[model samples]
Target chain A: MKTASPFLELEAAPARATVWFDGEPLDLPQGANLAAALLAAGVAVFRHTPASGAPRGPFCLMGACFDCLVEIDGVVRQACMLEVEDGLRVTRPHEAEDSGAPV
Target chain B: MRQCDVIVVGAGPAGMAAAATAADAGLQVALLDEQPRAGGQIYRDVDRVAALRGGILGKDYTEGRALTAAIRRDGIEHLDGAVVWAIEDGFCVSYTRAGQAAQVSAPKVILATGALERPMPLPGWTLPGVMTAGAGQILLKQSGLLARRAVLVGTGPLLYLIAAQMVRAGTPPVALVETQTRADLMRANRHLGGALRGWPYLAKGLAMLAELMRARVPRYTGATTIAIAGDGRAEAVTFRSGGKPRTVACDTVFLHHGVVPNTQAARSVGVPHRWDAAQHCFNPVVDAWGGTAVAGVFLAGDGAGIGGAKVAETAGRIAALKVAEELGRLSADERDRRAAPLNRLRSRQTAIRPFLDAAYPPFAEALAPADATLVCRCEEVTAGEIRGYAKLGCIGPNQTKAFGRAGMGPCQGRYCGLTVTALLAEATGQTPDQTGYYRIRPPLKPVTLGELAAMDDGARDAAE
Candidate 1:
């Protein structure tokens, strides 16, 4: 899962605190968009489609496309729309399919 | 509860300019935007990120700093991160900010909600690594991020601009898969005289193309049969170039064709709209100053039509001046005198729009995607399913949505509305105007029940 980032960490930019995703703490840049922070940390798989079970990620990061929906603090929101905050907990929202047997 | 002389719907180029102008004329203005900052998609975070990101976002984008500064200096009440859910009669706007409910009312309302990328639902577009070129730019603009290896797809100036931006950011896309045919460019040559008036835009596009060429990115033009294929994430894009099937291996596929006016807010308020035959979308019918048939309601910027940022800025100013005149803050003659230069500049700015519209139309085949291709990514409805609904006498997008639930998603039909409209038109053999758009309801974006219950009914009642 090694993805080289093209974003340069400019010295003038403010330093951000680390956030946790799936129990792993990631040191992401302060004030960067949450989606970019996750991607910068090599976590691109944001969520899976409810119907098709296909992996889906950010598209039209300006809130037009809802593909970047991720669960944060018990709610799902577009990751690109929310800014990265210190100590924020984020997790990929999963919708389980019916196994065809009665629960 | 807050009452203002005018409430501007968006804080983008149009809304910012509108608020500034009205406030300058002694009107109390309330500007609302869903984003944490002003500057709509075109200038998202321009006040902060543009200067920090340096030359990657381009000069036009950074120019939003001026608008942001002007609005702040004008002492206008700016409500950032406000999700306006409902607009009642008499211009009462119900919105939520930071999980708190608030209502703002005014006699006049200006809708500058802006434009969105035209939908292109191709096979495998729902894959993880696939996205729009505008989305890719958002990553760069908002977070300074880029894909490792991307293959840009489709056509239009935004595609080239994003490619150039990527090159500047030191991560040029692996290739460009263009759907526009050589014949299309030849067809656009007819309007070259008008297009030449805006030489700077054309020259900027050319410079971007040259940059892509210099970067040695393989550009496949006139591509037919463009498709993205992957197991779980995007692996490669297959497109036909020069009548030969070609596949480019890439991790990301960014798609774009053109933009269309976002008329949801206007359409929701029952504002009149007409289909623009050239742009192939609904244009809100407005006067010279963005005033709609609905008295107090105005439509400005790309929400009225796709005239780019400069045109949106001018349209916003004109709309504000009109508001000032209506409020008796300025005489009609004075308003017109102030607006004349902006009107002239807007005309010159938009002179080349017809040419661009004709040149980079949305992919016709995308209107009728393969039977299996997903039209509604949220609901997993396919084009074939929508066509089936159309064949069954579903005359409009709303009816199709009722039958199959294509647009009943979290996005509220932002991505699929135009595609559904076009698909229904192609299937039903009716014009897009007859096909119509989705019927947007109140609580437009999802709002919490608590936020709704907490609203001050007194404010809304007073305005009504």
Candidate 2:
């Protein structure tokens, strides 16, 4: 009826990780995506609209939706589709963040 | 353990057909079915729904009522709402009844657990109104009601049948988005020659299409729904129409890639499966008589192959013949005569399989869900996490479970296993069948710690 999850205890990945995200020193499993690692790290709200200021998060997790767009390295790509790297720099643009009080 | 002569699981078309055929042969059959009613998802219990909604039986399920009605007669013990979790040597079945651990022992076992529709992961597949094609059909068949202006996304006859039903139920879809090309449909139709003998089936399906056409349901072939643009519920779907992207405003987007056999129980028992290229899913190989590689265990219906209700009915009959022969109840000549119609049906099924398989070949390219797409929706595991688990020498789902915590949650891999398997297949270049479904075991659902401690003898308290 049930079984234990293998990834439940896994914290890190193989050594010498090289890929990078927004522009931060990220500690994540090798080959994991920015969205998944971020989700694991509790960064549920990934991006926001500039005009409406509505909160946007990774919805489909698949690249089909494009709801998880973030500034990775340099280009605006779907965070749900890309793998992770050490020392990745990930940043939320002012337009991509809700500017109201810290809710 | 309380013992019985035979225990047939899944009260659907195959199980009912199997139990009835065996009973007709004078074997005391104990039929264990998970649904509150006998009909599996195909006959999905719409007697009341049909009584309410009207005209949703759609021929295939209408034919199933006769077999279920046969269960009401004596000698066939129908245990509805009884979910069988595991089977052991001597065919000890572990299941739950009234939230209590229970078991049923039988000499011979027949697994007729049927197939389920494959939910293609798109942007909004998780949305409220977005559902599998079968789910939509169940809604209409049972309630004779539906949301207005649907966009049915899928391939094969399921979409055709369901869309036509939707029109009848008052939805009247704007257009049907088919993933198979017209050329593929032509190739699918070529097998129609061999299948021409099943004229009634052909006519019935054609009639559904006619309803859709008469209602002006524009069918766009080779289209895939890539995006669903709406808040909360589905308001519109953005799909690639014939390779060119377009958007259709429809409240409901009924989706179904195709059907895949529910294989968790089989996987748990180590039942080996072959890559059924025609079904694009893993299926256990069984002899014409329904005997699997495992002794005393027989496979039947869509669980063995993704054939329709007719094939399922015949498969059930063949299992009964084999069981009767094993019990020395069937004379050789009688058995041969009884098996004739099924053999003919198999030949016809073989003829059309190639076209159906080619047309609906599991949406391979769409397997890789975006990072946000929840692989294990219950545990919030994403496709990216699954990929991470894949690189760590985890070749199978069981091993991946150790590294990702994805499938080990409530909903028990129902929402995520297919999506994960497809992702694994894409990464490893293995077919979808090779990526095994979740392994089922006793306590098919979570139980309290006290319940485990209270367990005693596994054999039934008393035989039905």
Candidate 3:
């Protein structure tokens, strides 16, 4: 279920790929920028800060700022740096450790 | 370990041009870039996106195709999707690709790492939907994504350019809240002669503004006390414009003051840097031909200073020529003959820098945010905490890492270093140079332990 996203995709992708964000599967444009695809899919909050647990998203999409960090395949990396590869599993960094605890 | 005569880090205009030029001089050139394709942030993903979105992003961006194409020639080894983490002594460059570590050694290294958007910290800037205007442009260029009701804040030519791009994309911004006052433009007029010499840039900026005007994008100039307002995400922006408080409700806020040199790669390798007061950031000290104090290490493009793409490309060509001369591939006479025109081009390209710097100085509040505002997003360190550290005798950014973990995050002080120095300088009554910046070390980008252990040290030693 796609939420109402403020971001709009200017062009439609010829192919689609499914990637699991947290636990929800998002069918996104294949080969598109991962952070952008997720944003277009309405996944606003990319990760929560480790210190204050405050919600954070992609601030600088060019790899300088690490605010768009997400845990992928157990290694946390910048989501803005990655591409939308099919079957990729991404989770909020430290989400497993938080275990649904309030941020 | 792989060996090359020259290793060019970054695939931006400078790196691509350097690699191409060095290769043309018969030197083995290896180009490494963080992105999956050639084209650094300015021409990011140009190989794929230029054909589709060239009409929207403009000709200046599409022009990057020539440099990107140049890197694909013979004698140039291009490694895309490579994250450079360390540049050890003896010109050894270590990077990771595809979750695997690798090392390459070169007699000469050219750092064309380019610039990053200067952090514009404001109240509620840490909200989820608040992002840099550069980030928004990246979304547009890389994936054709556009935020429906985004408000652009802060001051710079880039703000106007992005607003115009959005207008062209048929989803014009709700408004542009600029921070530059009329006084700033008047102050910048002193450099009008140089700006006129560089008329093309000024003309392009005016054209963008005119496009925005035609699209009816509401613009608020001389905006001050700017702040994002929201709960979990950015819902609106509040600022003082025309001596009146104005609130613009929007789903997203894109903030940009200006860009600064990304000096981590250069500084990490023990390169000497000085605080550029005009640009308000630290820049690696380099000669006209991009020769640094560190031997065998050449710095070019915006990584050395905040020259834009054209200047960077010219600098890249000039540095490559100098490198060829240093390696005895080209004689001094030939190098000078080749570099003289590029030097002239570079000077012409940089003529507008002073005007732009004066016209779009970084937001004053962002330089020293309100006490409650967070300066360090990674550690949740507030400006008040940084000030407290200064009161407690913390004289520099290096010390703040120990006191409040301000620069200890994964970013390694890229975002907060300037702000931290500014806060300490204000509190301690010292210049930014006296206040000092973070002591940058290796592993510039985050590298996993497993990836580190998987390195082929035996091959490296054998090559050594």
Candidate 4:
């Protein structure tokens, strides 16, 4: 299956760092917002809702909606609220595993 | 125990304007925001995004460049990445930044917290790929991205704006589904005279509509029974348009139903708010100058109500001028004279609000979804479950929360509070105002024990 990406860099900005999403390495633009970077890499399913086990993605990427919860370096954070850095590890939180606090 | 003359929460148009105005008036101002940058959501990354993608986002976005630049200028202490979790009555704000707990105190505080998309609790809204249109716009604004194929749903000027933005980005939605009825548009026409006074806004909306028409994206109006359908993730949308059922195949479904002020901070601080019948939501009560009943605490911009960027910026300036005058920094005469023009601009900006509100009132059926639909995504509580509790004689949102864990989740009822009130109001014979909103508990947002420990440690350090 091919990964689907809805994002494309409009300008030819050079890649500055790489971040790992679900163990897949993706190069990202320097200072790029993490949520945008993940979406660009075709990783849309940020995590599954704990209550219903339904897959959920980022909504209201400004952190108003908590739908973009993901675990980064063992701490849960809103991907949209964070910036991409080199060598950062991102993972989806599983059921019964609490993501970090409310955004 | 740090003190400043003024502390502004939120860095959007209102907060930025407030901070800059107060600072320029020779007051010590601390501007705090959750994002690393100062531009609030409307102007998110205005400094960088405008320079990069200004042509696509349009003039209103690019206009934010001035506000962001002013926030970056001197006289204001800008603290980015600070998540304010609590606002105490004595004008103290407790927050966490970089895993450290701290507090900032001031004689006056401005909550320019901005707005959030009104919750549209629908079947499959909890599913992946079913996101808000604003979220999609943020992707494009932040990284220049759009869904490969998305079906934009719901109504209001924002709906058309985002669709037009997508068309400009060379990735227009595969389809556009509008839930607004012809009657709604007719009712809006009654406000035409007032809207005509704000010709610029009317023109902008018309331009966006024209762009969509020129693109010839499949358009559906008076949409009903709208549901996102997929096995687990959204892959198709089913709705009835013009009394005929239709389906659009798409990977993503973008939904928007206008916006509502973010009243959590104000409500937390015991600032009284009232239900706005015309707008169909509760708004923090503020005087003409954005002064809350709680002296020294104020709400400006959309957080006060659903005024757009122009009104928010002007309102912010007015609030700051009042703050400065109250704090003895600016004389009352100077404040009123400086505010005259901004107030006039605000009147012009909001002139068309009545028309927009009548045209795109809350989709009550959509907001109050079917029984089986998930009302609280965090707690996974269904509307059926909430209604069941209401049948058992739950009178209010707080009572409903106690009966079922609907509003106890991490979001702290940001998404579900309105929906819960609406559902309960429908189930019971009570108005939404009578049912009231959640009685918010402290730690308004989730905070770690470590962060609390740091607060004590920081206090000890200050004592030393």
Candidate 5:
């Protein structure tokens, strides 16, 4: 059986969208959900914990579960639920590192 | 890992009721839910409720508010917006919230993840802008993105409930298509009367019907959807009732039969399930208490059945009582005493269940929409691919995966799993429940290599 791909590999295409995560450049779909485009671009776990210091990732891709939640345009929201608007700047929530707010 | 005496998944009715009762008994309790807010689908957003004071919330809604307020107390730790990936041993769980994946462990686990829409495959169901009724409702509720004109299809109280909500939300429904025949509703009344006499739900249903008539929301019963018409998303849906074909011009269509339990957390921890002959879904058979075959892991709420919010609250109390007894927080006598109210509610609610099971079993025999009917919109697989897989002797989802890459997608097999499994089972002459989901792994979501390596080593050490 083909190993169930937990994530898809990003192919380098000329016509690509540049996604910056924590000041890093990544290729993304021109119009993908903030999370799906990120995942397709080889981005992984999108959040972290303040208490136990564990990593977090999306579970329910739909907006139902906030597991895929991230900070897009200065708002905490479900990354999987948000459609990727062109030039949308999304970052890990303030809870990840720095000030240390656990989601 | 952070430890608690009890960790209840889904802070809806079941989780809320369970946490409140258990915490009252002095056991450390943590209530977890996926919504950015605490209330599950039934209660929806509390702020939404708080905003519209004179809305659909009857006396029943008040209890939800009370439960949420109760969850706010010190003893009960509420984590809203946490999506559970799987359940590990001793009720250890992995979840993601705030774009981060984290782990929590508890000695006692109560899963109340609640219900999700069960796809009833039909022609044109996969058309763009064509969505499940529940999906449409979520889109409308969460983001206020709704079709100004639409059609509602399928049966049970939900079709009515969602229609009424849409009407209230100022997005009126154009057509209501119910698969259940008028005769079925009449027959259901025999049980409905008994159930209604005890609860205010009947009145609520009547109000919805009145609203439908007043709004002149064109309603049709015994309607069968033949196909959908559109280039990309749904432009209109074709249906027939009483041998007359009618095409409703719709920008959006909400298709639904009802909901089924989300068994990922339950099945992952090895909870045994049986083909629920009535609901036509797989439900873990449990004792009167929420105790499952798996120790310390109890199943409750709509995850068990389509029991409404009240029954879920009662079931939660029953499960919490069971948990309390095991945790030495309650005496055996107290546990027995707590079971009485729940038993009464169960007896009242279950009177209508068997009728429901028979009337609405996802109409499995009629699942194939049409060969031209799209099944996997994302992958562009159709009824043709299903038949091709069948001819290839792909007996199960795993085997089908070995052949055609059916379930490998962004959805993690949610949208296509049921249809693929059902089609395979039908072709192979096997029971649908036997065709369970593909093996699930975590991130559950994907993260960047940077996200993975950027983990703080000290914090990671603390978790382990």
Candidate 6:
């Protein structure tokens, strides 16, 4: 069943791809814009700032602002610039650091 | 490494036209874009979006289909998903594609890098659900996603365009909180003649406004002290409209003042820039043909200045003609003959700019946000800190790096450069030009150490 979301997807995708966001699996539209797909899937916060630990999401979907920075394959990249691919593991950058996890 | 006669960085209207024009003149051209498709932000995924939701974004967007199709001709190589990080001396361009670094060099380079939404730094602007109106449009264009109960804020044609688009998508914004006032329109009255010459653009704006009104989307004009209030996400927008405080509840807040040239790539290449007082941003100093002081380097489109997409396309053609002449592909006489019409069209297209700039000038508060507002999102630097730096004898953006690491973050001051300059200028009572901008360095986009090392290895292998 499609989950209730504040964001609505206007088009139906040909397929669904399961991508993990911070270890939670989300079945997003295959090959859809990653940031949009995540938002439609009810994942609002993409990362938390290292300074004040404030939540940040994609502000400029065109890749100007770095607010949408997410850790993928151990590298931080803009989620807005990426596409939703099946089995892609994405995590919020600075989450461990902000949570006082070991460096 | 790949070699071409001309290389165009960005696949937007300017870059597309440049590549297509140069290629049509028998010059080898490679067009590089950050997106996975040819359409730059203006036409982001135009081919797909137009096919799926025809006319939802309106004719202005779908019209880009012709330009996007123009690049399909022979001799034009389109490289997508390429994040150009550097334009080194000798016109060598370095970009990363699919986690691998690549190099493409050319005798001439056209930086048609396009524009970025002028940063609107209000309180709670960094909240999770607060995004630029351009972002909202991109969501609709790229993924056909629309925010539920969103409120469009700020002043500009783009804000209205997005509101109309949302209404077309059956999800009209709850309201529009506009900051432009009658005084702004009065200030813009002097440019009415020129704006009249650009009647099509004026007509489009009026039509979009009419569409919003017909949809009954309440619009609050002459709003001030606008701020987003939320716990961790945007819950509502608060502002003073017509001398009365009002709060509009919404899940999303789309903010936009206007767009300015995305000059980071051009600046990275050491091209000189000057403050555009009318547009209130720094733009590259370029000739009519888009040639800069940097030899063999040219710029076109919004990256040169904030002329819209149509102006950018004409500028691209004019620049390509000049570049072709420089490369001996066309005679000076032929280049001039070909460029004359384009130059005229570009001027006509840009006629609406002065009026638009004066009428919907960037919100005054956003130009220099409150002391507590976060100016530098990456460094989490506050506007107060920037002012403090100015007080401590900090002259320009570079010095802020040492004082508080303002422009040293991943974005490299793309978002906060103008605000920092404005803050420093206000605090020190210096002009924005005197206050100056960040010395943009490459890699322009963030690249991993592994990618850089691998790039070096790739270069060495190519040499061997």
Q: What is the TM-score of chain B alone in each candidate?
A: 0.97, 0.89, 0.98, 0.97, 0.90, 0.98
Give the winner by TM-score: 2 or 3: 3
Tens-digit lDDT string for candidate 4 (B319-383): 99999999998999999999999988898989999999999877766777889888888889999
Residues B1-464 of candidate 1 have per-residue lDDT tens digits of 77889999999899999999999999999999999999898898887787677588778788889999889865599999898888988878988888767888899999999998888899999887788888787777776677768899998999888888888878888898888887888889899999999888898888988998898878888888889998877889998899799989988888998888888789889998888888877889998889988999998999999899989988999999999999999998999899999999998999888779778877876867888899898988999999899888899988987898899988888889888988889898898888888988876777777666676777557647
Query: i-RMS, every candidate?
Result: 2.4, 16.5, 0.7, 1.6, 14.7, 0.8
Q: Give a tens-digit lDDT track for model 5, residues B274-375.
A: 766567667777878989888899988988777877778889889999998999988999889878877986788666565565454464324655665545
lDDT of each: 0.84, 0.66, 0.91, 0.85, 0.67, 0.90
**Deviation of model 1 at B338, angstroms:** 1.2
B92: Cα error in model 3, Å: 0.6
Candidate 1 residue pairs in backbone clash: none
lDDT for model 4 comes to 0.85
Docking class of 1: medium
Query: Can you tell me which runs of candidate 6 are displaced by over 4 Å?
Result: A1-4, A96-102, B456-458, B462-464
- lDDT (tens digit, per residue) of candidate 5 on A15-81: 5676666556665655444654564444545655332333445433455334455775455666755
In model 6, residue pairs whose N, Cα or C atoms come closer than 3 Å (at least 3 residues apart or on different chains), thus clashing, are none
TM-score of chain A of each: 0.77, 0.65, 0.89, 0.83, 0.69, 0.87
User: Model 2 over residues B71-119: C-alpha lDDT tens digits?
Assistant: 8877788887565666888788876554456677787888988876664
Docking level of model 5: incorrect
The positional error of residue A45 in candidate 5, measured at the CA in angstroms, is 25
Better of 3 and 4 by TM-score: 3
Among all windows of 10 consecutive residues in model 4 chain B, the one with the lowest summed lDDT is: B455-464
- Model 1, residue B10: distance off in Å is 1.2
- Model 4 CA deviation exceeding 4 Å by range: A94-103, B455-458, B461-464
Please list the residue runs of candidate 2 whose C-alpha ends up more than 4 Å from where it truly belongs after superposition.
A1-103, B46-54, B242-244, B331-333, B368-372, B429-438, B447-464
What order do you get sorting by DockQ, best first? 3, 6, 4, 1, 5, 2
Model 4 chain A: ten consecutive residues of lowest lDDT: A94-103
TM value for model 4:
0.95
What DockQ was computed for model 6? 0.83
